[model samples]
Target: MVRTAISRVILGVSIFAWVLLLINPGHIMSMEHCHVSDSGPSVSSLHMLLEMNPIASQLTGWGLMVVAMMFPKLIIPIQHIYARSLRRTRFSASLLFAFGYMAVWMAVGLLMIGVIMGLHLLMPGSYLPVTGLAVIAIIWQFSPVKQRCLNRGHNHLILATFGWAVYRDALLFGVIHGIWCVGAGWALMLLPMLLPSGHTFAMLVVTFIMLSEHLEHPKVPRWHVDFRAKLFRMIVAQIQIRLKEAQE
Candidate 1:
């Protein structure tokens, strides 16, 4: 029941994020709109250190992107967290775990924003950055390091049952899982950011790719490609089930 509720909540949030992105398209976060002031060096430093509005808005959109594209990947981890916690504290433990996970992604989002901004400054309207990122993503997709990260992401640690330890364990588990997730998906995530138009469509495609990849079981790290078409198989199975039900 708890797992069901959590899944529903995560699904709803993911849907909400998608809706927001669709309604406004890239207005919430667009690398094109990210301003690079050609002004005083000292003031640029000040803005870099103190500017909150742009930074805050970027983070907000990045958070939504994370929810939309990444939350589905967390269902298994969330289930594991729920199953391992004490009955009374299961909800709290799961919440902490999610918070910790989001925290890591949020921090990485900041760094990603910086990189995107730098690229924008260097090449304002060119597709060079996007193309370059796509090439890098393809290379990363076949790299042993990415496979190692994917394998590590499947790991679930033992949880504590009492006091602060419970919360600590849950949070740390989330942090560790999130780090692996970042390692596996960062290149793909950046691809969508560099797109000039059709940002939502690009995001959807990237999300599908990432989610499909996550559906795979852990495997030994290797420099090989795996499309992990598990989602397609599941859809086919569901279609067959419905067809049989209709016939009966």
Candidate 2:
């Protein structure tokens, strides 16, 4: 049943992601380039847009990016929510959890925009910042700190299943999970924003890395090389199963 739920959710997420990619893919992929420039709209007019729309629009895009890249990682937690909730409340509970999770990431997006603005002031249009961030991401991937964060992300809460407590537990679970996920992927997540071009591709690569890492079992935190290729293995296994079933 959990497998079926995961498959259905994956299908929905894939369709949503493809729709976002089909629409203004660039804006959806790039959250760092939110400022006005000389080649672009006028300062007064841009400032008006910025005041009225930019932040909100960027947050919308950021939310879509998270939906595309991070939702897959939530499958287990979401399944747990569904399993623990009363039949009638499961969907509502999951929605509340997603809202809580998205809330954290939206806050992070605002901070990330500020960081990018600072970088722009220091080195506008330069790849140096992106390259530096990529290096940092690589370092983080192998660090014990990253492992510890990933391990913490695997920790599930003992949910309360009655009254407001059920909703509260679901929301709190999402918030705590989002915090750990941010710790695990913030550096990598920043890469797509820092890139001047190929934002979609960068996002895809980061998503793959994150999904791979999430497949790993929590282990002793230590600096070690871990490619976390279980996702690839799982795909292969699934394909093999399908082929055997076809032959049967």
Highest-TM-score candidate: 1
- What lDDT is reached at residue 26 by model 2? 46
How well does candidate 1 match the true structure in TM-score terms?
A: 0.88
Where does the lowest 10-residue lDDT sum fall in candidate 1?
32-41
TM-scores for candidates 1 onward, in order: 0.88, 0.85
**What's model 2's lDDT at 160?**
82
Runs in model 1 deviating more than 4 A are: 32-53
Residue 207, candidate 2: how far off, in angstroms? 1.0
**What lDDT does each candidate get?**
0.82, 0.79
Q: Which portions of model 2 miss their true places by more than 4 Å?
A: 25-28, 31-53, 240-248
Clashes of each: 0, 0
* Candidate 1 structure quality by residue, lDDT tens digits, 166-196: 9999999999999999999999998888886
